[model samples]
Target: MSHTLPTDIRLHKKSRTLELIYGDINYELTAEYLRVHSPSAEVRGHGIGNGVLQTGKQLVGIKGIQPAGNYALKIIFDDGHDSGLFTWEYLLDLCQNHDQHWQDYLQQLQDAGASRNDGMIARG
Candidate 1:
């Protein structure tokens, strides 16, 4: 949970990708991931007490990151899931939980009888 500061940051807008260098570790963040892992209560829910599943975000992309405050960032998603304010801690959480969380999301979608043929939702 202790993350080093990023020494370098790069954004490929055309590809909706963000690359960061922190000490010896490098990270690649897709706009899609940022959009789905938005820090909004609408996304994470209140204090982790709720289980709101996010679907139909396979094609969602981050339009931009709006400054929310000194500690949080407002992420704008192309799919209109732009209400989330992602903090550095939250972003780190997303990175750490990426694999498990993504699998859970996929399973949730499958349970709901959904498919990603459209690739319009994040479920794919």
Candidate 2:
């Protein structure tokens, strides 16, 4: 499958969002969403079914983004996480499936009794 690279990328520091433009389609992804869904081993783990749940990243912001060769981007987060290399294909997937992915994440957090806020867990 071929993935079209974004024609434009913008970081909105004040809004804590990253915007990507692919022709007529535009997508804005929050920093917290990107951080939690990072394609890094630390977040995705080394094997299937071993992914880690990321919490306390509600206020995370993008520090910067750098190109990884010709196919991917290295995203830097304000919380000092800079390991993930997001490929154009992966970014497109995230943008296209944003709603479902986000809802799944929220459900996972709920199941784990976790909160988005730092160091907070809901008790019930």
Candidate 3:
């Protein structure tokens, strides 16, 4: 309900990207990035060391974006991940620190001996 909310949010199927426009600034987020960085507890886990690492999302695409009240967007990934509530602040942070965050993600995968081509991590 605030005027600071994003004016436009669009998913481009051809490009496999989400575009967010807020005032005069615009951000383009790849579905891959969104998937890897989902805000769900399933991805983020419960505590500091409990976070789950997401892998093999390089080709993921956004299936849809639904509103969560007036504060966040629920993004459904083509891979069937739909629990994350992407709040305005979180989305903005992702847009601003994407490069660093992406690098960290790649490093995490390397450290875990994981490959982005291997699909999601198998959970028991």
Candidate 4:
């Protein structure tokens, strides 16, 4: 299936969220969500089944957003991570599956004993 490219994209620095409008759909993705789910090799890893779980990113904010040709975006995070190439399709998928993805992330954190706070312990 082909997804329509974003018509508008806006960053809310105070809320640390990105608002994307793609045709009839509008999505608000948080910085933490974007950071943890970055498509960069540092987060997604170099191969399948090798993704690194990201922690300590609950409050991470977007420092900037740049266009990557006509197909994707390059998001720079305040934490000095600036590698993820957020394609239009990926952004659409993230919007459509935000809840499920967030739940999965929470479960991963639980299983790994990690917390939203970096280097902090997760309590049972």
Q: All predictions: root-mean-square deviation over Cα?
A: 3.9, 1.2, 3.4, 1.7
Better of 2 and 4 by lDDT: 2
Q: For candidate 1, which ten residues in a row score worst on lDDT?
A: 115-124
Candidate number with the higher lDDT (1 or 4): 4
For candidate 4, write residues 1-124 as lDDT tens digits. Answer: 3454778899999999999998877899999999999999999989999999998899899999999988889999999999999998898889889999999999998889998877476767
lDDT of 4 at 97: 94
Assess every candidate by TM-score: 0.72, 0.95, 0.90, 0.92
Cα error, residue 28 of model 2, in Å, equals 0.4
Whole-model lDDT, model 3: 0.88
Report the C-alpha lDDT of model 3 over 6-117, residue by residue, as the tens digit.
Answer: 8899889779999999888999999989988999999999888888888878888888999999899999998999999999888988998999999999999887877787
On the 0 to 100 scale, the lDDT of residue 21 in model 1 is 69
Off by over 4 Å in 4: none
Highest-TM-score candidate:
2
Model 4 vs truth, CA RMSD:
1.7
* Local lDDT at 118 for model 4: 75
Residue-by-residue lDDT tens digits, candidate 1, 10-117 = 666778866656677777777766765666778678876575656566666666766565566666777777777777676666666778867776787678666433
Query: lDDT order of candidates, best first?
Result: 2, 4, 3, 1
How many residue pairs clash (N, CA or C atoms closer than 3 angstroms) in each of the candidate models, in the order given?
A: 6, 0, 0, 0
Candidate 2's C-alpha runs over 4 A off are 1-3
Candidate order (TM-score): 2, 4, 3, 1
